[model samples]
Target: MVISEADHARVTVAVMEAERHTAGEIVTAVAEKSDSYHDAALHWAVLAMLGVPAVLAWRPELAPRIWEGLVESWSPQPAGAPLLVALVGSVLVFLLFRLLFTWQPLRMAMTPGATKTRRVRRQALALFRVGAERRTRGRTGVLIYLSLAEHRAEIIADAAIHDKVPEDVWGEAMAALLGPVRDGRAGDGLVAAIAQVGAVLAEHFPRGENDVNELPDRLIEP
Candidate 1:
């Protein structure tokens, strides 16, 4: 999901060309992932731990079988000692499962789709605020944000553009951007989306003689 230097250059060129006919300032950004989702991992670990006791409770024979084995192995130990060992063992199992989910892929897999969507949207908005909103002279700045891990893209337009442009109008550009992403061509996706957005902006905000590049054309990798 990494964006190559060559791809970054191509995206930058697309931004430059797109702005030629539009007063809208486009800013592009890509992030490897929106979040680590440690909380999701922790939740999964807790569920797994809780399931252990639930299973034992549901199948009473299962615990007795384990106790028999422990008795044979530690006959000299106090009866209560085996219970302590079992408790410690359960804790260890929970800890191990929790640690395993710390890996990004495992953690992300356990996360709900809705959660990932929220995180991606949150990240995209943050980028928009920093990179596009409140920066353009005409308040026509737009942000195209992509979160590779979530395979999600967001197109955020500043107040001026959003007021005049129908919300659904951005859907086409977002579709264009996501098409390439779905095909694993992130750079191409961004370039195509930029062109679509430029076309839309050109129609509504035609370039003026005083129009200048108010935003950097480079792709922000956050």
Candidate 2:
């Protein structure tokens, strides 16, 4: 779901077009994912591993069956054969769970939506600070951030714009941005979002005579 070169060009053009009528500097950014979320996967794997022993303990007969199946040889084994089998089985169970979590899709599935949302918001703010806020002359920079893996969109506007425009005012733009993302048309979504944002900014902050293009129109693909 990563944005391609063509998508980058489309978004850049959108930003350029949108900025023409407004003083707001619109920056678009797309990320593969907000976070690695490895910790969540590890927690899930540990829970699954722990369940193996609990299940075996509850179903005492199944433990003996597993032990017999593992040692079919008629050789005289120790009296603690069942306990040893349980220990080896538990180790194998833990390894299997850990290996399963190595798959990216499974690991992502184990992560909660709330965690993804928080991470996306954090990345968006960080990008805004670096890519738009510092670069814009009037402190009217806005960041349209998308996290493809998490299917989340975030809008981070600088203090100047945010002070006047309520947070809910950007809901329409955010919805437009996420609409295409939901359907795998990320480029189209970004363009639509830019247009919506431009309309809002144009109403509030029309381009001034000495207005300069303070920020680059290129897409920030971090």
Candidate 3:
């Protein structure tokens, strides 16, 4: 779900206030989802297709005639009957699962945490490159990216700050960011995260006389 207009305004103000204390450029971006995760969806579909045959083989009673012909008659079934049933059932199962997974909530739930994390990180880094990286006069740009569907966030810093700051240093900010997000308070999470990040930047790259607001203070919704 998209944040309210007030939340958008709050985010913009947070960025501006944060930037006031540090020369670092802070760009905030929120996305309903980072990636379609189509590959993961396809993988689950394929697994479902493959599983149908195994289930049929294990429980012949589910499709008895196809496996061993009529029980009373005891006739030998056509060798191809089971195979055909399996093929058709597999295709049907695959299609059913694929259709069900098209629903966003189910797909998001079924997706592995690692996959979501990787996709969020990848998207966040790309956004950082385009929106924040090296765009500042001091090469101290920071991007706080949040993926609502994935329930994950990424904090990417420009080269200067990245080189100086330990990656784990953002843990506190990320933690602060997600607590409110878990409660469906994404805007609050973002504001809190940006504040923490700003504190860090102010400490490392304190405001200078020649500091410039190199980036727009807006919440990018993409």
Candidate 4:
């Protein structure tokens, strides 16, 4: 199909908007569908592929071999270059939707909410119940909750915590929760450990010294 430039632009904008709306859903799907390490490895490979032009600019000799390999690997009676370019472009666009638009929001929206709570329950019922306890931590007393029901595990903390803690801490906490169970009763230590983690997070992302009213009772339902 011959896609016009105007049509392409319009479609791209629409896809981006849809990605913004469903970013969380896509991230959840990716997390559930694949291991984090595997996904990270794929991302690194793509980045490396993206860097090929720059790499070749510095080391031109390697380009001949790379081109030869690509040609050799090309199928017999292969599709025309234009068709191949179109196919590859389409795949990359969809991957951008999956990796950039979808996954970015999922990471940003990693907090306890109705949608996330549902996900946690799906993953582990016992963990969901125990992890649902919201606690005030640190001198500031930020609210943090951990949930484990859905395909992707999550730690939900108050928005206040975002600027305070180093990003790596959050990453570590998530890896811990999502990683394989170390002991037979891995769930046993989760709550206390998460609470302690919350305290540490609070120190960086402190809450108001005064207590705010707990969330409305309606918001508290499982």
Give the candidate number with the greatest TM-score. Answer: 1
- Write model 4 residue lDDT over 83-187, tens digit each, in one string: 444445446654664565245335334433564555453444333234322332321222222332233544443333434555457565555544422332223
Model 3 misplacement above 4 A: 59-63, 66-77
Q: Give the per-residue lDDT digits (tens) of candidate 1, residues 106-198.
A: 888779999999999999998898888989889999999999988998899999999999979989899998988988999999999999999
Each model's C-alpha lDDT? 0.88, 0.85, 0.89, 0.37
Best by lDDT: 3
Give me the overall lDDT of model 3: 0.89
lDDT of 1 at 138: 96
* 2 or 4, greater by lDDT: 2
Which should have the higher TM-score, number 2 or number 4? 2
C-alpha lDDT of residue 212 in model 3: 77
Quote the RMSD, in angstroms, for model 2.
Answer: 1.9
The window of 10 residues in a row where model 4 has the poorest summed lDDT is 22-31
Estimate, for each residue in 18-62, the C-alpha lDDT of model 2 and write its tens digit. Answer: 889999888888898888888887787778767777787788677
TM-score of 1: 0.92
Q: Mind giving the per-residue lDDT tens digits that candidate 3 earns over 1-222?
A: 568999999999999899889888889999999999877888999999999889887987666564544344466566576778788889989999999989878888889999999999999988888888878767898989999998899999999998999989999999999999999999999999999999999999899988878888899987
Q: How accurate is candidate 1 locally (lDDT)?
A: 0.88
